[model samples]
Target: MSHHTVSVELENKPGALVRISQLFARRGYNIQSLAVGPTERPGISRLTLRVDCSEHTIEQIEKQMHKLVNVLRVVELLPDESVERELALITVGAPPDRRAELIALGDVFGARVADIGREALTFEIVGRPEELDAFEELVRPHGVRELARTGRIGLRRPGPRQSRAQAALT
Candidate 1:
């Protein structure tokens, strides 16, 4: 029942997302959040996935994913490793009376007000999931009219850069 984040490298091609998502569905696993975008490498895209599953099930899924034609690699991100992660949150309709207080709380969590309107204010925060939870708890009583989040997007840290020689070999 633990939550896990996995990084999958795949070929940039049509129906790639559909194929991956369908694998999870067919296995009865729930994807908490998914982010897909191009990587530095040409013709390759990276998918950051947060899903809830057991280690055994995840291994099964990884093996299944490798069997697909487009899948290049699947690596589960471990917390102990050097990694970079970010998330953005938006809160609307913040009570005017608590504006200063909410703003201060956001400051404590390294968040900033992104937009302001007569009836609403949008705050954008980029950080780990735990940081987002703390920010949400601080602003909950201050009239959070709406909330939206982009779940963890990240990559390994301090890894050696691939030289042209190494890249060509791969």
Candidate 2:
């Protein structure tokens, strides 16, 4: 099954997340990644979910989400129409001799040194999911002490709109 990213708008209230999670469980759809946060509008939250399912199953899931009380909106984030990102904090063993090496590696991957301990260096990386994965692999040989990844969060891209004049020109 391929992966699909779904964006949901939920009411910012207690038990809202529970209801959604229960629905997924009941449907036997495993969530690969989920991120939830408040939106610009008060009393509303946005939930981004990554699930592995077929097109038919995803459609059914979306329909079920629409019937839920807390869910206000449900939309599949098509890759071409959305921008996605994930954040990772990786703590790798860094001996004094290897500190400069790791730092240079971080520079190539756009990661920053979040913390610099004598034996460990915590690097902060923010990028697309694949980019994060590549960084993780590159640093694994250094002996990772800990790693934390904030699952993907995404928003639809606002492409160029055709105003009246633009439409006329086109």
TM-score of each: 0.87, 0.93
lDDT of candidate 1 over 1-170, digit per residue (tens): 78788899999999998999999998898999898888999999999888888999888878898998999999887654435356665665665776777678778877989988766787899877777877777777667878887767767644455455544432
Q: lDDT per residue, candidate 2, 13-132, as tens digits?
A: 899999999999998999999999989999999999999999999999999999999999999998766778999999999999999999999999899999999899999999889899
Candidate 2 clashing pairs? none
lDDT of 2 at 144: 97
Worst 10 residues of 2 by lDDT: 161-170
**Which has the greatest lDDT?**
2
Clashes of 1: 0
| Clash pairs, model 1 backbone | none
Candidate 1 regions off by >4 Å?
A: 82-84, 159-170
What lDDT does model 1 reach?
A: 0.79
Runs with alpha carbons beyond 4 Å of true place in candidate 2: 160-170
